[model samples]
Target chain A: MERTRAPFAALREALHAAEERTRLPVARLLLLVLLLSVPLWPMVDSRWLRILVLVGIFVVLGLGLNIVVGYAGLLDLGFVAFFATGAYTYAILASPASPALQADLNWWLAIPVVLALGAAVGVMLGLFVLPLRGDYLAIVTLGFGEIIRILLLNVRGLTNGAQGLFNIPRPELGGWVLRSLDQWYWLLVLSAFLIATAVGRMRASRMGRAWEAIREDEDVAAGMGVNTVKYKLMAFAMGASIGSFGGLVFAGFFQFVNPSSFTLAVSINVLSIVVIGGMGSTPGVLFGALILIGLPEVMQFSETERLLSVINPAVPFADTTDWGRQVASARFIVFGVLLVAVMALRPEGLFPARRPQARLPERHESTA
Target chain B: MFWFDQFVNGLTVGSVYALIALGYTLVYGILQMINFAHGEIFMIGAFAGWAVLLLLGGSAIAGPMLIVALLAAMIAAALASSFSAVVIERVAYRRLRNAPRLAPLISAIGVSIALQNVALKLTGGRDRVYPRVFPTGEVGLGDFSVGYIQAFLIGSSVVMMVGLIVFIQRTRTGRAMRAVSEDRATASLMGVDVDRTIVTTFIVGAALAGVAGVLQGLWIPNIRGTMGFLPGIKAFTAAVVGGIGSVPGAMAGGYFLGLSETVGRELLNELPGVSLPNEWRDVIAFSLLVIVLIVRPTGIFGERVSKRA
Candidate 1:
């Protein structure tokens, strides 16, 4: 153990040094991110902007999931269920195609309802799995996810049964109709920023400490006078509401809500982003979304075709080679390989969250 | 008569589920982790069996030749599944044994995705038809009857279970596996090669799943890349229902789930205005899992889950 840890400790120190070099203060980093993203809408094409929006959406999801699986130590595999609930809820209330309600609710007016619905669903699921631990919790949540999809597919009257609710209304603030890709991208970016800030604050609060304790050991946390149940429920509700928010945005952006979009794969994708981005780390989630979501979408571009050919001169083009198409299809495969490789080599993720350092009073010379 | 037929169908499907469930039970017993990629290994087994059957001359062979081909296919599938399982253990699991529990599971999910997509790409995203090996026939006893393929499936499953029980009870490697599962640290201290025992467990479990895959292909007559997902989840449910770490428990749970899905669904349908479509089968299985988890977390066999979980 000593021998093995020697090299491991060295590696960790080197990694810490590298992290310190790149680490910017929170305020400056936020400003830098905002400044960089400000140019994205004007500089990139609609397609790229759309992809960035998707990435931003996933970042929000990753952060939300980070609260549950990362900070709270609850591995909720059925997270997509919450996302679906949010999207379906929004569509059902807002879309003209909605067979049941067809309230034609404005998108802004629907926010509180959608958020509350998301939180309610999360708490309901939390209540169900409160007793379950680790893998059991995971499988049950996975079942829940499947159950939601099945319900969406079969519930003909409410969900339109697989035909799905289309013509979903987009968010319109006052007179300005927010329909453009850039507008959606900005909305997502802003939402992600807000969610991240809230999540960071949550991680530092008393509730956050309670969640950490519960995550470490529920029985121990309970013994330590922490109300494990309350904190766990809080974490679930918080995470679920954020996930639903992502779903609401997703429905608005696509102007459609379908059961097919919410599958085990979506849950896995979000979970992967959170895991590969360094579980509890906010920046890690952002980085993860960029690499996992952004890279795949970017690879579909025509420019990437040329880039691929250049990378491997032996690779042919068009029908003879068609490496671009093949690569695009192979993205999930790459994702899986990356997941395995990361676990094998660096299980902490690409950007592991730093533990808050304790501040100590400087030693007085007289006392010394 | 309808109930009887459903019972037989349940048994047939139950046998396959039991086989796959054994894999989950074994791995979970040893590592206390879910191997999410186990389903993909089952998929590989189906493809392997299909390949062997094709090589043996499609659906034309009959009698003794068909028997030989089927045996060969099962062996090939077992080998393929075992190989894949071992690689997964080496690459995805072995290193993460001491890491956070989420790491291996997420990695396993990744493997499942990767394997499924690879199969989709290789097969051009189409189902491969299995050659008709079992002769189309059924034996009847008054009002009761079972198809030839169904009989073969049930019979083979029993034989495998018996063989596994014997192997575990009598073999040195099997003893090692049990010891490791009972207590890995102590087992290692006792001079048992913990790693080898773990690999052996994976091989044994995966082999059963592989053969189950072949059986499913033979039963369904069509095998696809994404074929393993549903059955895999159902079998995992079976494992949990019976008792995750218990072999006999898994077997019983599989049959229980199978019966409930088929006969139970029919039973529910018997109630006025309770007619359920076939797709509801999966829903029943999932609901049963949730109910079991909620009401009796320790499972029917009572594996003392609370302490471990």
Candidate 2:
């Protein structure tokens, strides 16, 4: 009877350990369901796919920015510069004007090139501003962004100037054109998931620890044997590389590259996503991107507009001549208000970092 | 001939930048947070002045009434700027005092965006033309020529700067401001109203931006919702360049940035193979900011503050 009892107790302990091992994976699976459930809803509109794509792009951007602003604690006001680099890189490389390259370069090819270029630019910029920190760093980055934009605007031969590059072909996988919004939506989801997973792994690795150390106290981090300069450069390059990847995807999906698409406003929007979503957490970035991107898109429906019109009748305007301007202009106000409210009330974010749950010990009687 | 004209043009713009920088420096000296909305205040001031001029000149008030309108606009700008500063402090900053340092910075950005949108809504998303209040006549000083508008902007900015210097150095409140800036807790113990002092710092800074706005309207002759963004950024850069938290530093930074922009453009034109068009002038200005930040983080005159402080 004692032998039988001992075997039962060991079996129960083994079962408990297995459950604990699978807990996080189960949680992740649930989160995946929640994310995918939107598309599966019976009442969900096809237009939502487009919004999801945008959310994916913003998530990519937010994750990249999280490394710089969240992990490194650097306020980078000019992050859009990397986005521009990627977009332009794709534009120039894929465009027919290039001697060897056709107007429609393969998506796979353009992405790596864009990322490499972005990383190079990031490294260069990091070197340039090595001496500056805090507000000074912010201002320099802002200037750098403007410089990139101005160059894009003025360098007519390369960028096609303010008119921007258009008619670039959409991405194709072995003639399987991702032409539909739904296909693109799925593509973005897959890519975002992969990137998020990789980012999660990276965050738990040695590099992530270095970033945390640097953020908390740079001098102390350096003293603790963390290679401060190397880690900072790594953060910048990795962040820029991720941002460029998003840009490549964006350019490929739209089949157009314009200077206006990558602006200080774009940088601000991404920054707002990181801040509102929660700075350092992976899930926080995803949530932030969804809210910032999805909310605005959802608000753009005709019914929603009509409903808002009832609240402020004067807003819709009697003349429909400039309806586009009215619609476009409303976005800035909404974005601004959201940014302010989020920063004021919940600066930490909606899904702040949660403490890991402890395993409960089995109840046992002490041997006399 | 055109070369000399551009130099004068640069000086005039630089002087305006100097005026705006003063406000940034003053606020930073006390709060250590950059007031991102200060530029929007400048834009609002210009728009207000434009609106006032349009109303007064178009209606019963004419001729000398225009001067009265200008004075009214200046006073209105000061009040408006001060009010904005106070409100920003109350709503956005006060709560974040004990939070992470980045908290206020983010809040400031939010305020900036909100104010920009407000300005856009107020202006109906269009540029408002300022009434031709300042005479466009240019006077010759040797080979260089300065417009009447330029003179007015420079002169008024200098006078305002002098008045501010005197106020800070001479008055009890100004002394209190200095004391608070030097040490907030100690100043509070010494009977300084720290909150009030911070609010006052914002007001003074905002008022200067307002004056600069009026001057900008007079000189530029057009105002838009986003007109303040670049100028505001440049002014902040100027404040940093001269030395953030130093009153005189703002003036020096503004002038330096302005002069550098002007000279850089001139130099670019003179380069054997390179020539940047006039419309792309902002490129030079922004590049200068990057270069300055890289070379001198403390700026030319700015002293580095202890991180704890």
Candidate 3:
């Protein structure tokens, strides 16, 4: 494992030759997949499953954003709008607030509706933002996101305002209720796997190459007869669709929908996962999701405080001290600092795509 | 008369927004970067003013001394914010000068979050009442009146804007700043000291924001760590509506945004069968942003650049 470069290279070469000789790529891939999924099954009763579901939600979100920002090179700061939209759609349909709709709607029936609505909204937003470029586009998207949240907050008739929609009906398959943490975890695992695979395949397709070209240089891509506007819109809609699907899962797991949950911070967090994970890599997004979700959970302050006091008798601060609360509150400061440090040090993120690039430039400088 | 009162009110608030938007405009004009932590500097200004008020034996002083004390607090606030702005420029933005657009933007966001949290820690997330140093009396003709603080704001903001116009149009340093904005590389090559110009741009912008913060203390008087967030966004919106990277555009945008938000709310309320909530007022500013981007694209005073990405 600690071999020098020469040995490691020789071993890697031998392994590749052996792999080619054996033609066991599929077998090895399956084995790797099995190894990943098998461990999740045991975490059924544990809180780890809850964390896994959280990571899965982000995975779907990161995958969604990867298409727009990573592949198409659009900087969208309003991604949470789509996520919130998807969640609210399901929440409104299933919650008791809309009894007429909920009494007849099943989870299976609601799925496609959410997906379609998400895609439609994405496209609608896409149309509005299509003409803009770079930071101007970013600000417009941010404004749109705030507008959605404010609209949600004000349109008390549909969303129940800030009180939020609770008692959202859980998904079911005939007689089986998908209510347990493990059940939700499995559902998310399947969803994440499906999304990652579909997106991964899509990344290598002709459409993906066109998107990559646009990302590299939209003008050049357009010069080459690539329909930049259409491809960018498609990327937006696709990203929105996937992101909203994630929102659907989040609503299902929590059995609630709130405007507060879908803030600009959430969008930034998802963006962080994508950017920090290596923007275009599917596996990187998952790994980022795991780190962001699991790391915070592992650093649960009260438990850490207890461990600290146990390890050191001279510890003056008690568990009930304001110091613990400060640390909890200070996590965001840590997160903010980390975001800056990472963007500065490694803009490529933890794992990078083929090209670790900067943001696309805007056309106009007269108005930012 | 009622409309007159509303008009006066809009102008007063618009003056405040203009004060805030000037910061956005100045920085954007020179650096082409949105200083996201600017709002936090505005907050810092308020806090610094509060500290000054305390240091001057409290806000309970009398008459001429009160005026002198208030002015001192405002100057202190301006200095504090200017210092903070320079620090943010050097530490967060300087290193990533050539990095992609996302890096600086994300770094700005990070600084914003960190500064806000630091403020929250300092204040324990409570809203502190800023002292009413300025006289609270209203003065004017019958049925057309303005508060003492509002008058002060309107008067001071105009003076500052006029003073700024003079500085930029007449001064050598201001000419250098304009030169940098026009072409940074060329300006640097031709003895502009681009870094100094950028730093000056930040200081001047931040100082206005600090003064705006003091006015916020005078106007609203209830200050909190998160107070800057909404106003910052609105000012940014104003900057855009005026035309981002345009000095006069930002000024015009701020006042226009302020008037529209106030009068727009009034107009919305008057519409038959429309019972829009008060929370909708905040959305007006953001909505204005979207509409401007869509319909105008170049904003009110912005010069249209015909290019595509």
Candidate 4:
């Protein structure tokens, strides 16, 4: 075990050293991120802005998932269920499409409803798999995700079947009509910032330590007087609440809700983010979203055709559409392979979450 | 009579699921890992069977000659699936044997994705028609008629299940498999040839899946790359509902799940104003899984479920 970790320790040291070199404090880092993105706001077109919004949303999702899988050591394969629930909840109660509501609710008003729904569902999931751990939990959660999607797809009158809900009323902030993509983009960015801050602080809290202990070993965690079940449920509720924010923003941005948008692949993609970025690393989640979501946008069909066509004039543009579709389909394969490779090689992820070195063993012994 | 017909229909589908579920049980017994890619392996078997038919003068030829061709296709499929299962174990699962239990499962998901994509690529995302090698005709009256394909599926699955039990109880390789599953290190120490036994467990499990795949194609008359996924999940659900590592439990669970599905749909259809769309039939499996988990986490037959899969 030590041998397996030797390389990672060295890498961690190198990373720490690099951080020391660029030793910007938390306030500076936040300001730097905000300042750097200022140029991108005006330069990017709506298409690019849409991609950026998705990236931010994913980052938020990754962070939320990081709390569960990373800090709490749970493998949630059905997380998209909660995301779907949040989005669907928003669409149902806050849109004209829902005949039951008959009135489109305000975005601010809908946010709490969505959070409460997400939290309730999260608790149900936590309770459902209270006895299950690891792979069993994963598969059951996967079933849960599928069940939600199947329900959404089949509930004809309510969900509008496969055609999906469209033309959702734009979100309003105290009577200001928030219609532009830029406004929604900022909403997401702001949400991402808020969620990340909450998650970051949660990671350092007493409850957070209990989660870490549970993640390391449930038996030991329980032995230490930690209410493992309650904390586990709390983690789920927290992650769900954060993810619901993403969903609410998602519906607002597109003014659309579709069952097609939420799938196992989405859950897996967020899992990959939590994984590839760095399990418990807040910044890692952001980086994970950038690579997983942003990289794919770059590789989308249109981009692929232009690049390929430029390289070879004889290449027919029309035929490249097939190539594009194949590539799009192939992304899951790549992600899957990447997941296997990454988990096997570096389970700690690209940016291993930094724990306080001096405090590690004392916590372990205390828990013990 | 409507209920009886649905019951019969459920039994036919149930047998195939039982065959697939057996694969899950066998692998779970030995390695204690959920072979997520097992379904794709089943799909591969179907495709291999289809390829054999195409090679052996296509579907245009029929009669006694077609039976011989079909037997050959079944063998090809079993062999193909067995081989693929071994490869998956070696490439994706071997290294993670002692790692966290979740590692292998995640890796298996990767293999599942890769294999499913391979199938999609090969079939060009379309369902491949199984050459109608056998004359499929109903052999009953009054809407209670059973088709030859359906009979063959139930009969063959039963035969296979019985054969597996006999092999396990009576054969040396099977004994070694049981020994390894009981305790791998001890089995290795006791000269059980642990690695080979594990490989054999995979082969046997995958062979069953392959046969199920062949039966499915023959029964449904269409094979697709993605076909393994739904059945695979259903079979696994069957395994879990029955008690994951229990062979008999998987069989019972499969039948129960299958019956519930058809019967539930039948019941829903019969109830006025509560007729759900046909697509909601898929919900039966998911709901049953949740119900079983909530009611009996260890499954009906399982003595105990490990904290992990």
- Top-scoring candidate (TM-score): 1
In candidate 3 the C-alpha lDDT for residue A219 amounts to 81
What is the per-candidate TM-score for chain B? 0.98, 0.93, 0.96, 0.95
Candidate 4 regions with alpha-carbon error over 4 angstroms? A1-24, A27-47, A174-185, A301-329, A356-368, B140-144, B268-273
Interface RMSD of each: 1.6, 2.6, 2.3, 2.7
RMSD to true structure for each model, in Å: 4.9, 5.8, 5.9, 5.1
Highest-scoring model, DockQ: 1
TM-score of 1: 0.93
Model 3: share of native contacts present? 0.46
How far off is model 2, as Cα RMSD?
A: 5.8
Candidate 2 docking: what grade?
medium
Ranking by DockQ: 1, 2, 3, 4
- What level of docking quality does candidate 4 show? medium
A160-234 in candidate 4: lDDT tens per residue? Answer: 867778777777777798877666667777777777777777888888899999998898889999999899999
Which scores better on lDDT, 1 or 2? 1
Candidate 4 chain B: worst-modelled 10 consecutive residues by lDDT: B300-309
lDDT string for model 1 (A86-108, tens) is: 89998998899998988878888
Evaluate candidate 3 and give its CAPRI docking class based on DockQ.
medium
Regions more than 4 Å wrong, model 3? A1-45, A99-104, A291-294, A306-325, A355-368, B304-309
| lDDT value, candidate 2, whole model | 0.78
* Residue B234's lDDT in candidate 3: 82
Residue-pair clash count for candidate 2: 1
lDDT of each: 0.86, 0.78, 0.80, 0.80
RMSD of 4: 5.1
